[model samples]
Target: MNTMLGFLLIMKAEIIRGWIITRRYWFRTLTGLIIGYGMLMILIAGFFYSQPAIEKGINQLDDPTRATNYILGFIIGLFAFGVIGMFTQGIQGMAQTGVLEQLCMSPYGLVTNFLARAVVASVTTIFYSALMVYFVVISVGGKLYFDPLPVIVLLTLSFINLLGFGFMVGGLVLVFKQVGQLTIIVRMALFALAIFAREEFLQQGWLVSALMHALPITDASICLKYVLVKGQISETGQFMSVFLHPCFYWLCASCLIWTFIGISLFKIMENYSRYKGTLGIY
Candidate 1:
């Protein structure tokens, strides 16, 4: 009970710190929002420009539902990028500034500290993603089906899944300290996967399908699309169908498995780095 209380206090402190940082850098935050909006506009313009050629190859952008799918996927990709960045870039920044060792010395330890940070980052990421998605959808005249309950549930699960993946990458960072290129590659892969992953991909073959299900983002993207794009709620206005879906189960299992793997890997790598006396080395 004391451990849980300590964890909660750590979380509260991190949240307060995050709020202060954002508030202190208000101009920077506003600029980021503007930049994000500009980039989103550019992407939409490019999609429109390529619609003709894309139509000939694949009839993907002809309908509102399809457009919503693409937008939602892009938003999810952005969320994933932000969450992962908190681990990759955040750790690197701490290491470079020589604060990494100080954090490791905290009473709560590195794992608890980082987990608290992840929670704060996830909350901010979700807020920003939702804000951006809302404006983009309005600008594009796209209609998305949003049931508050299911959307919140799926988003929470997706956040957990991404957090796990972030921990894995963060573990690598603790040992490597200069995995910028590798992190970029992984981020790009996740971004592309978020945009293209669909339920249909699960029908390819057992091996292929297994691989899709194993990814942290694949089932998440699919589940969100079902709720947001396909309107998968039942006639009784319940999400029982969504709850019963195999992908949903996979998402739950994936969250548990990946989180365990990530935390375990992080602990192993953390110990190895400490043993090598390189935990503070940038």
Candidate 2:
């Protein structure tokens, strides 16, 4: 009970720290929101409008409901990016600033520290993503599914899966000290797969489809799109069906396995760093 209380306190402190940082940079935060979301909306809207072939292939863009899928897919994509950034780059930032060693020395542990910060960052990311998605949908004259329950369910599942990937990246950063190029490749590749992967192909038992599913967030993205756009609850169905569905079930299993592997790998790296007495070195 005491340990749990201490952990909670540490997490609370980390969350408060994030709020303080954001508040201190209020102008930068506000500026990033306006410029980032505005530019993305213009780019996406213009590209689709210009590319008749792509637009036709995707179906009637003028149809608000049908367009929701495309918009929501980007939203999920942003969250996936967030998961990657919040862990890998989050750790990288600490290491560069010589904070990782101090964090590692904490009695509460580095994993808890990273996770506490991540939880707060995830909340901020979701809020920004949702805001961007809303305006982008409106810009394209697309109707958004206003239901929060399904969206929350999708986000919860996606976050779990991505958290495992984040752990893996964080572990890599712990030992390597620099993984910027690798992270970019991983992030972009995963984002592409999540945003534009063909559902029909993924349903097939092809090697490519299998590979895509092996990556975190791919299956969840499909399920999320189904829920957000097609008015479907799960890509498969409701209740037990949600659990039984290949997409959801595989995602849960992958998250559990990856998370385990990631934490174990981080422990190994942490030990190695301590042995070398290089925990503070960049």
- Which prediction has the highest lDDT against the true structure? 1
- Estimate the lDDT of model 1: 0.83
Query: Can you write out model 2's per-residue Cα lDDT over 50-164, one digit (the tens) per residue?
Result: 7758757445566676556766766777778878887777777777788887888788787777766677778888888888887878777876545577667667878877887
Candidate 2, residue 171: Cα displacement in angstroms equals 0.7
In model 1, the worst 10-residue window by lDDT is: 55-64
For model 1, residues 1-282, the per-residue Cα lDDT tens digits are 765666788889888888898999999999999899889868865765676586542444445567777888898988888788888888888988988888888877788888877887788878888888888877767778888988889998998898898888899899887874479778877887887888779999999999989889999998898888778955466655577778999999999998999899989989988888777777
The TM-score of predicted model 1 comes to 0.91
Candidate 2 C-alpha RMSD relative to the actual structure: 3.0
lDDT of 2 at 183: 92
Off by over 4 Å in 2: 46-63, 233-245
